[model samples]
Target: MARNISLNFRVVEGRDLPAKDVSGNSDPYCIVKVDHEVVARTATVWRNLNPFWGEEFTLHLPLDFHHLAFYVLDEDTIGHDDIIGKISLSKETIAAASPRGIDSWLNLSHVDPDEEVQGEIHLDVKLWTEAQGPRLRCHIIEARDLAPRDLSGTSDPFARIFWGSQSLDTVTIKKTRFPHWDEVLELHGEEGPLRVEVWDWDMVGKNDFLGMVEFPPDVLLQCPPSGWFRLLPFASAEEDAGGKLGALRLKVRLAEERILPSVYYQPLIDLLVESVLSPAQDDTVTPLAMLDEVSSGESRQDIATQLVKIFLGRGLAVPLLDYLNLREVSRTNEETKADRSGLAVVGRTHLRQDLDLGVLGYKSSSHVTQGFSKLAWCEQSVGAGPGQVRTSIPVCRICAVERVDENAFQQPHMMQVITKNRDGQLDTMYIQCKNVNELNQWLSAIRKASVCNEGMLPSCHPGAFRGNRWTCCLQQDRTVQGCSRTHSAVTLGDWSDPLDPDTEAQMVYQQLLLGRDKLRKKYIEFSEEKIKLEQEVMKGQSCLEEERSGVPEQERPPTATAAAHLLAVLEDLEQAHKTFEQQEKEQVARGSLHS
Candidate 1:
């Protein structure tokens, strides 16, 4: 038979009138767990802080849970150790609460306190024991005056700041070592995530490191060369060798960029109500190693596997087995929104969450985003065409005559339409609403109002596409990989030479010619600078490869920072040349087939 645990409680300051006569409560309760497995709990009804006014309580459980997993609670909630904290009795500590029985640990019923008696209180839980591993404890050590105190850690970069609400014309600054995470520190988030760091201040002072979340580059072009991606370190653990944890001290101020997704691909589904999203400040967040290999020629599967090994060996990642509660947040909100709790589907839920850009279609060695080619077309004349003249008008009228298939929005009832300029015509966007009311709302909250990319409304009709008007198509911007951006279709137009066999080819030629001069210059400069790096790798390989040949390449491939990266670089350049060759071969086959 299995044994169960019981909790004993007594209020110190707060009234503890025997809430439930649990003299015989036999539910084998656990304080914290990683998942189904309990990691830490009390062996006996051990005394601890009370859930009320810092009283004392005792709980009993099998002691096997002392050092296997951690605890996780809802954003402000805690485990059964307190009145407000609740979980499945076996969840990890992805979300932590203030210390036990503190004033900040309150029930949601008191979200707005009327007076002292009616005041709100926060609940908290405690892990019986902490592991002796290198846990990069990113203690959000400071924030606005509303910032909750009472958070306690063995080490800290704990600092504080205050963002008074609006109408307060003057902003007052406060500095102090927050005593603990004892109080509910988060409030008035529309102001900002009270800035805090989780690193040693001394290191930051040494390097003069004023930082934001060290994110992957925000706006990389699709299929950007691997060499372009590099890590930006906010803090490093090497700076604080004496401490068990490195504090990446963070600072927060209202900035427009904060609201935008770290990358355009990661969209915001929703915020945790009153909870503000503070940036993560960790010395360990700096890329431990870029998993990119020397060659893009290797299959992505092999590359990812190799990179995983490299990242683990280099300390960028612990084994996927190390961390519990490994989750995968998706790119699309619709799919995730349907679930009561979000799920990381597909390979998205790997234990190693933070690695090379796996989320935003930016795998170090993958071309998933650039899998399809990008082409340009023009939007010609408008009005119903032959395709629509005979069928339901839902068909794109303009696309029927001009090139419409390319513009997914050429369908009738398009909510929005954009016509691109060819010979310097003013760009235009037409939007429709069921009624004026919705239109007003859209215009009032039109988040993306302006445009700079004028490439629009071109169709591919052998001849009539550039006639007069254009059409556009619309597609939801939900990315296949858990993203939240939206996508739309457009059409474009340009002059054509009826006598010539090809119109697109001619336009492409002219555009390429016009841009070729600048491109050629840029290419030369890039090559001049790049060759030195490539040469060094080749030089090293010359020495290394000759001496060691029996070893398979993957086992002892070129160094990530040295000759190996050049393989990717050289291959990218070669890929372009190969594409042109493939095109030429296809053209030859067409002529032969016709002949």
Candidate 2:
């Protein structure tokens, strides 16, 4: 499937740039290149060695892009621009960072010695694609003198073709001055400017730029135009500053064109989301791999962050993050064979709990533990206690945790932990912490952990335990086996262990998005109710006014006492309706803020 991804690059700032002009300063601007094609340029920052240009760009490309190049150039009005320095990062290097992406200051390298410029550029790269349809076939036949950019006197050459947002790459020929690649690559998207770039591949550092050619789609509409197209030097500061660069001999031509409808691409998007929600076991063909390859310049975190936002808007953030966390856990498991808990225990404290109606006042709590995977406690007698152990809870089994009023106990730090027991009964445990801070900490931890456990599969069923051993692994009786796992029924929540503020915020954000529609519906229903009740109240007031005006009434009550009672009831209802309307308006405001 054609990958849907974008590269978000920010040319944030520059530092310690050498002077390219006579005034001891150079006006620096950034030019970003994918392969040999210039994709973005920043506005010039004049008269400063340290230039701060917070320029950002978003570009869509095929997964075949080799390297991203950033060139810092000094603008010259009278002639060509001056080269300061350049830095290039490969897709593999960026992909290692993935999802969160990269933000760092890279020491600028790859400067022509004769140009006399040096500096570092602060850049941020993120992988993302918001939201393609035709197959354009191209054949790369051969190339020549792709510049000896390597110190080895020969170049490993490759060719890349770009058409609008889509791109294709030919196989690389090793150690050849004139490499031949008789390969055909097919791209999907609307037709636009067809760009071809030749480059010398390097195992390390920046790849050498050979040359590039551009042809309009009109050039391809004809019979596959085949011939040697002379490669041109990249439009760089070196070229502008009266420096000569070599070119390449290249032969490529369009082969065929097949336009596809929009519906044809829907499956790709569906697969992309599906892959994120439930990643494929095979990493090579996974949607995440495809996305990473296309936006190799972007970090995987960028993609995940984008996916999180998208899912949050769609009210699927909880499920989305859960899947991602599981994928992460599975990947970690594969990499390291060490035996460690998947869920990290977060906090432990001494507290008091409500045991039962049989026990009187609060007793000294033994050990109260809170973790991403579960919660557990031990209790003792009022003095140096008896350390009786209570049942440990799997975090997933928890439904709620709330603050409670300290009445009889008079403990300032009081809260309740609610979970389901083995019998599927609501188990509420009232706990009193040492202080308010401790109470808040435990409350937040329990709440965050519960949210993390939202979509996790039970590690093993509650009934998986047959005496001391788990029967689920035997798989002898399908009716009795509740899950695939044979052990660790409550250990499933380790994937999202050690909850932090960011995770907390995400849960809140998801709730707001989830409640958005409900809030709107609620506001409409309340408004309608209030309007109806007000109308009735107004009609009653109209009837009272008519009776007081001494007008003839239809079937009037015989006594003034009944009329007085009716007016009083109408007044009471009007006041009650006004109060209810005020409360509804306040609720709507809160919903708006949350949303």
Instruction: Point to the candidate with the largest TM-score.
Output: 2
Model 2, 122-146: lDDT tens digits are 1111111223454566677665434
Q: What is the C-alpha lDDT of each candidate?
A: 0.23, 0.47
Reference-based lDDT, residue 18, model 1: 18
Per-residue CA lDDT of model 1 for 1-595, tens digit only, reads: 1122222222222111112213422112122222122223322222211221222222222322221121111111233332212222111221121112112111111111111010011122111122542111122322211211112211122323232332111121112111123333333323222222222233223311112222121211122122111112233221212222111111111101111112211111011000112211321111111111111322233223323322232232333222212222222366634531211221123323434323222121222121111111122224433222211111111111211121223332223332333454333233333332233222221211111233323322111112232111011222111111122111111011011112222222222333333332332233323454345546765422322232333543223222222222233333544565677689899999986
lDDT of 1: 0.23
lDDT at position 527, candidate 1 = 38
Q: What is the total number of backbone clashes in candidate 2?
A: 11
When summed lDDT is taken over every stretch of 10 residues in candidate 2, the lowest stretch is 343-352
The worst-scoring run of ten residues by lDDT in candidate 1 lies at: 111-120
